[model samples]
Target: MTPLGVFFLSIGLAVLLGTARGSMRRLVLGGGLSLGVAFFAFPFSRALGFLSRDALDPTLLALVPVFPWLALVPVLGGLVWLLALRPQWAAWSGILGGGGLALLGLLAQAQPTQLVRLVPLYGLMEGVTAVGVGLGVFLLRPFQRGWWSLVLAVGLGGLAFSWLNTQGHLYLPKMVGYYKLLLPAPPGAEEKLVAEYNASLPEKNAVLKELGQPLLRPIASLRDLEGGLPQEAAEAGYRLLQPSQLQYGALAIFALSGLMLGGGLVLLRRPSLWEMGDPKAALILTGVLSTLLPAFEATEFKLQKLAKGWPFLVQFVDKAWPPNLANPEAGIFPLQSVLSEMLLTVEIALVGTFLAAVCAVPTSFLAARNLTRGSAPMRVVFAIMRAFYNVDRGVDTLILALVFVAAVGLGPFAGVLAMAIHSLADLGKLYSEAIENADRGPIEALEATGAAGVNVLRWAILPQVLPLFVSYTLYRFEINFRVSVVLGLVGAGGIGYFIKGAMDAGHYDQMIIGVIAIVVVVNLIDFASSWLRSRMV
Candidate 1:
């Protein structure tokens, strides 16, 4: 089916279902409003150059094959079974049909190759489905007390195990090799091993040289050449592994045992637990369990090594403190250069926030549902704008900076653009929410008079929301300032570039200076923004 067809059909189905659920008047009204909105959504989006005709074709074509297998088959089978045998099982039939359709719709967008890579996700889906099925069975036969609890518990345990196995965390082979290497070798083995190890260094260095790009070479060198147990073990013809290696199996066992114990406790306390009466509560419990189980199983929980590093931390502080208050040696990044770059970072945030605020003002109006009321075309436009905001905000500033760097090449310009784009989305959403939540009384009064749409917005809406917009813009500027420093690490040009270089060359003192500069600047901005926001509010 075409995208339009699919959309209308879905709406029709929703209307039908709503009618069946005894909400005919609401269903009809909502369906009409939805259709009206749909009528103008595509055209307006197209006129704005936001909608691409080519993109729609591929999406619709992908869904074509999915509809028959997922939608038609399940619905037909359900209809036949319901008519011929169990008339009372229509709800289950609808669930099966709807679930299949939803799954197909999700899968339609993913390439087969991508799907193959997501085999682990299939286990998660299956686990969730199994839980649902077990619950359904319980609901169908509630008289069989405690049966569903046991089923759900066992199913969840199996799911946890499956997820753990898929994550490769529970794989024993790698751990076994590391453990074997930790065992001591005999006297004769040492001399021979030393000869072999010396011979291997050139080969290892060659591999490192080949793999290490200039950008990553520092990290590679630190890992491969650093004076650590791993390095020592490698030279002695062995491997060194973290304490997690020994504790991993025990952690996994404990995690699974804990989950079972927790599940049992839930079952035993079902009557008192809120989930006993609420499916939503049960679902939330299941989700929480699923997440906690994997995290508990994978966590190292070993802190002895961390405790051992306290002395080194102190030594680092001793070397880096007082920050060379006098005329210090001008390294690659001189003090003057660091100070200038820090100023540039602040400038980037200021310019970016200003640009973002300018772009966001108009877009926020389009995105505010309250402002777009009674206008189907405008409501559709609101959704599109909201989606744009969501997508831009969802992408990280660092990732955006990288893209801008690729497009516009490295420097503060790239950082500025990246910050601006991210801040635009953030500020737009904030601005829209402010507009939506503004006093409707003022807007209604203006509209009731001879005020036009634009006049109503200008006179009534803008006055209420402008202060909030300014406050949010200031807050976003502070965030952008902090993020800009990190952007410079990726060659977007600021103090972070110097900091990254200091880190790469193991210049702890310089890194400390850079960090101190950031802290002072950020605190200043935070205080100023807070004070401004307080006054604005």
Candidate 2:
């Protein structure tokens, strides 16, 4: 689609969405944002050498082989829905629609040759695609109007765009893939060349058998034929066909995206649906689309490449399976192996959670609002402690692992430190909340008896919150173990480190072993932790 066409299309889509949702604000927001995106993103992207005019264009099949009568079902259904609901028109519309269908069926049966000819697949697909779009939009249950509006608008725009222009295909459900692949267009001369060769192959092979020569190989594609075919085959007008792979480039992605989006437009037209939601959602959605559409161009997000690339992924999966538990390089038999690495990973998680819990138990009392109240100095400490927790939590553990890996060198020690530092903040926050929620009656009763502050806390707050602290610690231990696995990927030691080494050396079998170990150990640890937490807490 041309930039100008996209620009207008965006605005129209936004407006339609607003109308469907019954929100004027949505209409304005969607239209304005869509126009802004189309105006700035699409054209400038083209000018900046990000996309060509046809960059978004998926190859549209000009004609499709859907028998034209099949298209009539939904069209008639829609017409009946639109016109037959009225008290005055219901009977007449039903009669006319049903009789018209019956007559069309009779005509097709009478003249099967001409009446059954291929119709424009685009027209059939337009309704079918729109219906697919509607199904996707139907995902809303407790339907929020704002998000629904955004979806319907985009779907309407896509279904409309398929008619006016051809930008690349968005895979939905082979709905558009059907257009990409099965349209009624005849094979090009290049394709016909291969077809001709294959058609003649049986005859040639039979002759070869009679002459006591080797039989010709069956041709699946142009590549199957030998260099320039035999000289006789070439002279017989059977030069190697152009690669058929080129035809698949447009249809590469699955058509799920198209089915959902187009289906939405059809649903909106037919369903007389309305709901309330934030209109700003439409504006937000449009802004995102503006950015993402351009990003798709910049990133060249074509799924078609997968057609040629899927073999590599399949090959990797095949090699990676049946995890190798034994490693001869580590040691013979069961002396040292993945078992050692797995044990180290558990130690890292165990040590990190232990350290964090030890520190947090004492420090969290100062951070709790109830404990720090009634003293200016304690309040200051509370603010400082809370700020520290927030700052520490904000810094991700993996990033901390990278820093520690550089400073401490690559080992489980680095992973231990990263997990401990991060877990301290997490445990501190949970512990403080538990402390703040402790019952006040015991502390007051103890304090009234002239007990020291420390004694009051020991007798009252500690007893109340200790079980919760243990529960929280067990939870943190579970999380820390998982984090440690990731830390190993960054050279902070454990099974992640072993896995990374195996992957880098293309020992997928060994790598899969590490992955399986991590999974099995994590599930076991989680189950054990949950049981202990339930029992102790």
**In terms of TM-score, which candidate is strongest?**
1
With a 3 Å backbone cut-off (N, CA, C), the pairs that clash in candidate 1 are none
Clashes of each: 0, 30
lDDT of each: 0.56, 0.59
Q: For residues 22-103, could you state the per-residue lDDT of candidate 2 as single tens digits?
A: 4333332233234323322232110000122212221222111323443453355345434533423433443444344334
RMSD versus native structure for model 2: 16.5
Per-residue lDDT tens digits for candidate 1, residues 1-537, read 333244335445544434344322222122222222211111110000012221111112122232234234224333423321222332333333333333433343232210000001223434444466555655566445686666665565566546544663465333212211012234454345345546666667787779893321222211242233223333333322122221222222222222222222222323122211222332343345445544654685448767999999999888777565335464454567679989999999999999999999999989988877777898889889999999999999999999999999989999999999999999999999999899989889988897998999889988998888888888888888989899999999999998898778877776788888899999999899899888887
lDDT of 1 at 36: 22
Model 1: residue 385 alpha-carbon error in angstroms? 1.0
TM-score of each: 0.51, 0.51
User: What would you estimate as the lDDT of candidate 2?
Assistant: 0.59
